[model samples]
Target chain A: MRIFDPHIHMTSRTTDDYEAMHAAGVRAVVEPAFWLGQPRTSPETFYDYFDSLLGWEPYRAAQFGIQHFCTIALNPKEANDPRCLPVLDELPRYLAKDRVVAVGEIGYDSMTKEEDEVLARQLQLAVEHGLPALVHTPHRDKAAGTRRTLDVVRESGIAPELVVLDHLNELTVGMVLDSGCWAGFSVYPKTKMSEDRMVRILREHGLDRVMVNSAADWGSSDPLKTRKTGLAMLADGFTADDVDRVLWRNPVAFYDQSGRLDLDDTDGEPKPDDTSSFEGNSIRRGGE
Target chain B: MPNSGTAPHPSLPLTPEARAWLDTALTEIATAPTTIRTLFPAVRRHCGRAPLPDGRTVDEAVRALLLAALPLRDQALTDEVGALHRYGDPAEQRAVLRALPRLDPEGTGRFLDLVRQTLRGNDNTLIEAALGPYAAAHLPADEYRQAVLKCVFCEIPLARVAGLDDRADAELARMLGDFASERTAAGRPVPEDIAPFLHPFTTSGTTTSGTTIHGTE
Candidate 1:
């Protein structure tokens, strides 16, 4: 069962998490750009973070045998900061990168006027860049936030199919589905949807455009929630093929819209040259 | 120890059409006044990803060409080249590192940090790129020796490392010899290619010069 975690903040996770995720059949992941726990004071900070998402993070993930792709955005919370607005001018350059698959995590946080404007602008950038958008529904007012998110998404004039309203729950799922957009559920440990609940959502939703991710980060979260959900589905009599669809193919289809999802098998350990000088000293032992 | 050959291998030189296209593209970009921030990623679309005769993609070659085309003010050129590598994806980074010898043939040592960064990285391709002609010409002797040893550590062919013959020294040979002994004591067969580098240490009172020793037969 190959799992493609459509949303996981590996920057906040450790190498242990990567190994565990790989051991649990997570072959690929997409780490969306989002605000750190603290507010960033300037756009220069955002540029470095975006560079990491595009450069360092992917390189690190590859070392652990995980193919990493990322979505670039200002993130809703930071969108309110006057200092960070300059990032919008730079978003197109990052958006044009090969590993950047979407304009992401880009919806309302507090649903502020600033968040409103930033979200709309990034959505337009998505449309212009021909990339998909990952819209984050606010945690505080879940129901209202998603509704307003849907309204903003509709008004942005981008195709609903090119949009995914993420961090959804039972209340918002039906509306997002009805809006012709793909639904993303972040299965976390305590707060977000649990594995069994995710399984139940799949059972109800019929696994069309639904994507299950750990959304694991610096907070209290489990990186293998996607795999656990897969197991729960299997226990509930869902076929392996069904698990593959929700876990792998669904995210691939969503990000493939960017025409840049390099799901190639380039994540494995570097193969020793066929004609290396020191054949006895494999790379594994050479370090020692 | 200057690296004079900045052009692609003769066997796989750029097509005249590709060359002309690159000239026009670089001219437009040069006038537009963006360094790597805007133009680096666009190189592939204009240059195409088809393989040249030498097996490197046209995109990679054209990126090098575009980088070398930057205005020749040393500091500005260095800044642009550094930004391109720093912010670039792995492929883009590789293009810049691979082109360093051609871009700075004088061995000015302005780009050692980029080479060092690549050496510190775990990406084997980037490691290979970091050990090219520019690194050979400019990297300090001690660092150069370590970089070569890193190639062995990463299971890369020592033959792929440019300037290996010119840079091979007594200390490097001794290190390879010590490594060979460690493997042999573990009852493992040593790397066949380490023999040339190891030969100087094994033979007493006579060090071979310009022996042309690459690992494969």
Candidate 2:
């Protein structure tokens, strides 16, 4: 039951979450740059946070036996913040780094005019960097927001295959699939798609480019949903092969389009012993 | 065998010969994870204590091979190194420490603590390896200052201390002044390497005598 969650916020989660993730057979994750809970006062804050996504977070994840990759972006929620607008200008430096897999979490939040402009620009950044884009549909008025989000993505001039529309639901998945871009369903607890609902979607949609993630983060979410979805797929009469295609292969095929999803699990280095540190700074804290 | 002159930069581009050794090692390590231990005698034959595992030295080959662990998917490399550090003999312990330059970005505090521990012992070979570029680049300031004094206490030449010249500070000068006093009190000659760093903090003695507190004009 190896899993590659294409959308998760590991920076916001704890090391214990990483342990639980590994215990549930999650091998690797893509932590997309999203809005922090608090408003950032300056772009320097984003720079430091981005550096952690690139450096410290990866180091921390490795200690837990998970290979961590990230998506760099100006998240749609913060797009409305004029103070954070400069982060879009500084996006290129972070995008050039080795671990970045996409220009992402980039799409409509409140579906504002400011959100629209930010989406178009970051999509262009995706094309310029030759990386994929991960689009986040607004939870409020999602049906409408997802529709407007698709229009902006269409106009970005980046190939449709190079984008992944995330936080998708039953109403929006069909249109996103029709657009030829990847569709991501977050099998979260309470609000988003649950495991049973996700299994039904896999049965109906037939698993070509569909992927499932926990999208776990600072919000009320579950990191184990990817695995729970896999279990549901099995209970719903999907074969092991079907589960593999959905949980692992689907995300790989999508992110592999970037030509940078170098997951070392199959590439065959020994597992990392992240229990070490640089100077005195360490990801290897005592206990679980 | 430590390259006391100039520690090899961790990112030193591998040459053709070194590349070949690493290739052979990576392939072999895939099957035998502990082949790193089997490599030391070969290094002794080709290059005694040289950190660059290259050409015919089995040690470098082993080192180059173990580096493959650095990129592993899980905690295997950390566990493997941890296992070696826990059970390995002094030479094996030194080999793991020596490999830190190439294998860094490693997150365990144990490795740094191990390097600090080596400085307190009488083994110059281990101390020299521990003092290489990784220590220079990563050892925290307080630990690094104490590490220098450890070298002086052990009579290990400060020449082998990587980053000694670059990271030296006034605090280190003061610490060295106290170390010099400790040596003089014990009637052991203070190694002259103390002179370069000691001069900054030492002041003249009172009474207008021709003598100075640091014992220099």
Fnat values, one per model, are 0.33, 0.00
Cα miss at A181, model 1 (Å)?
A: 1.9
- Report the CAPRI category for model 2: incorrect
Clash pairs (backbone) in predicted model 1: A278-B191
Q: List DockQ, one per candidate, in order.
A: 0.27, 0.04
- CA-based DockQ, model 2: 0.04
TM-score of chain B of 1: 0.80
TM-score of 1: 0.81
Which portions of model 2 miss their true places by more than 4 Å?
Answer: A266-270, A273-282, A285-288, B1-143, B146-217
**Candidate 1 error regions (>4 Å):** A37-45, A80-85, A265-288, B1-27, B30-37, B44-55, B68-73, B152-155, B171-195, B198-217
TM-score of chain A of 2: 0.94
Top candidate by DockQ: 1
For residues B35-60, what per-residue lDDT tens digits would candidate 2 score against the true structure?
74444323332223334434223343
Q: Write the per-residue lDDT of candidate 1 for residues B80-191, one digit (tens) a residue.
A: 7787787787778888988887777666678889999888876676787788777777776678878888777667778889887876777788888888888789997776
What's the C-alpha lDDT at position A61 in model 1? Answer: 67
